[model samples]
Target: MTDAAARGLWITLEGGDGAGKTTQAGLLESWLRERGREVVRTREPGGTEVGTLIRDIVLHHRGDVAPRAEALLYAADRAHHVATLVRPALARGQVVVQDRYLDSSVAYQGAGRVLDAAEVRELSLWATEGALPDLTVLLDLDPAAARARLDAADKPFDRLEAEREEFHVRVREAFRALADAEPQRFLVLDASRPAADLAAAVRERVTALL
Candidate 1:
């Protein structure tokens, strides 16, 4: 098949904080490019101009933004990201490997903030104009391990990541729930595995899907 004949592939990485999504995302990008596929590496919250502003508000918040309000900001950012970046890239038949997307909002703002998943998904549809990933790579990890990685990284965990331990636990559980809800769309792997091996496994999944 011609390069342009392949449908646009939206691959998202979903997990708790510090699940090594970026590292694995980069690996997939390079791997796909080697096969002559056009790659559009992007992320939610900051993929577009307006989205970047919303990202700052969401991540570096000075105080608590109400849960639903925070969710709305994420929705706004995603709206812009999908319109300005994701849709256009997909129209060109590029492989879109994102660091995170709708699932992050559902896990963080939905479960972490104690909102409804059904409501959150509806908001996502409205904001992203109904964009959904073809496949999602879930780096399932224990909350303790994920938290330790964040703490050891020596960087501020930011507003969402700076949530209480219990909150993070909820987020992790929410993500696992999401994977269960969409088995066909998710490649859920344990995070306790070696990074290299995990990366290889993720690569194999994306390779097979493409």
Candidate 2:
């Protein structure tokens, strides 16, 4: 492995909207910090200034954005995010705990938006120059349950969040397919479980990596 690849532990949490990824990322960050680990907690589509602007365009634009354009926007954010924030933090030997990553693009744009998954993934690989997480914790949840959680939150849905249930179902399936394809790199967890329990499971898996 290259020195860049060996720099630090890159961990990402992925799931459909309202799947508890943000909550778990917080817990993991706190847990790691308690153990004296220098942890960088961040998220996709808004990890940097450039990405934050791209995020609003992609998720909160008033009108329609062509599917391909949307995908490319996400790719652009990923490129900047990895180079400016993620890779540098990792190179400093910090545990980078992120709320979302490239897999989200594959699931949301590729599967949910009905684009070519392989092509979308290839675009991201080219964008980030193939930077990948050491581990990706996938919070698996049923689309209906996920929707219910979102509804309970009572917040206006973003563009992707407002997508139909069918879109979210496709996204869920895509996430599972990704986990199955690379079992060693992914830790799939049921999102319906209590948050504490899920955090414990994550802590266990992450401990092994440390």
Candidate 3:
């Protein structure tokens, strides 16, 4: 591989719960592996042992967690995840297909929880030493639709997913605003579309990066 190609790429999938991010991420990872590229598929809040513990508290804890405390927990997970997993994979020239990142924190904690969005973002940046994805694919879907998908799946809701519709609405708006502010780095797509279509669009973007 060329020097630039050997440097690796970071791609993050961001969206509300049940937005098909996992489906798309799996497709992207498969496509990249088919092309003989090393791919590290991981997710925030549960990407490592430390993160898994944090994930249980933030996502599965039965009781309420203070907004700031929740955000801090996520940031702590991000710090460990990036330092121990993401950065190392990238340094080895492996594509990191992460399920979520700082953006999710900004949307869920900042917008949904009514915390300061900028502060949440800054906190995440501090946690990760300013690490940012090369490309962020946002699966834009209506809150109601996403909720319906979750309901149809017959799965239990996590703490965040169990929130009210208005909370999810705020999260959707926050994600849109974030994508608008950084158009160059985000590839926003309609998540209501077929999985194949979404995967194709994602692949087109990643193909250019490759």
Please name the candidate that would achieve the greatest TM-score relative to the true structure.
3
lDDT of 1 at 173: 91
Report the backbone clash tally of model 2.
0
State every prediction's TM-score relative to the real structure.
Answer: 0.94, 0.97, 0.98
Q: What lDDT tens digits, residue by residue, belong to model 3 across residues 1-210?
A: 123366689999999999999999999999999999999999998999999999999999999999999999999999999999998898898999999999999999999999999999999999999999999999999999999999999989999999999999999999999999999899999999999999999999999988
lDDT value for candidate 2? 0.93
The digit string of per-residue lDDT tens for model 1 on 48-158 reads: 778788888999979879889999989888888888888788788899989889899889988899999889988988887677888899998888888899989999778
Q: What lDDT would candidate 1 get against the real structure?
A: 0.86
Candidate 2 lDDT over residue span 1-210, tens digit each: 134336878899999999999999999999999999899999999989998999999999999999999999999999999999988888898889998998999999999999999999999999999888989999999999999999999999999999999999999999999999999889999999999999999999999888
Report the lDDT of model 2 for residue 80: 95
Q: Is candidate 2 or candidate 3 better by lDDT?
A: 3
Which has the higher TM-score value, candidate number 1 or candidate number 3? 3
What is the alpha-carbon lDDT of model 3 when measured against the actual structure? 0.95
For the record, the alpha-carbon RMSD of candidate 3 to the native fold, in angstroms, is 1.9
Candidate 2 versus truth, CA RMSD in Å, comes to 1.4
Cα displacement (angstroms), candidate 1, residue 193, comes to: 1.0
Residue 114 lDDT (model 1): 93
- C-alpha lDDT values of all predictions: 0.86, 0.93, 0.95
Error of 3 at 44 (Å): 0.6
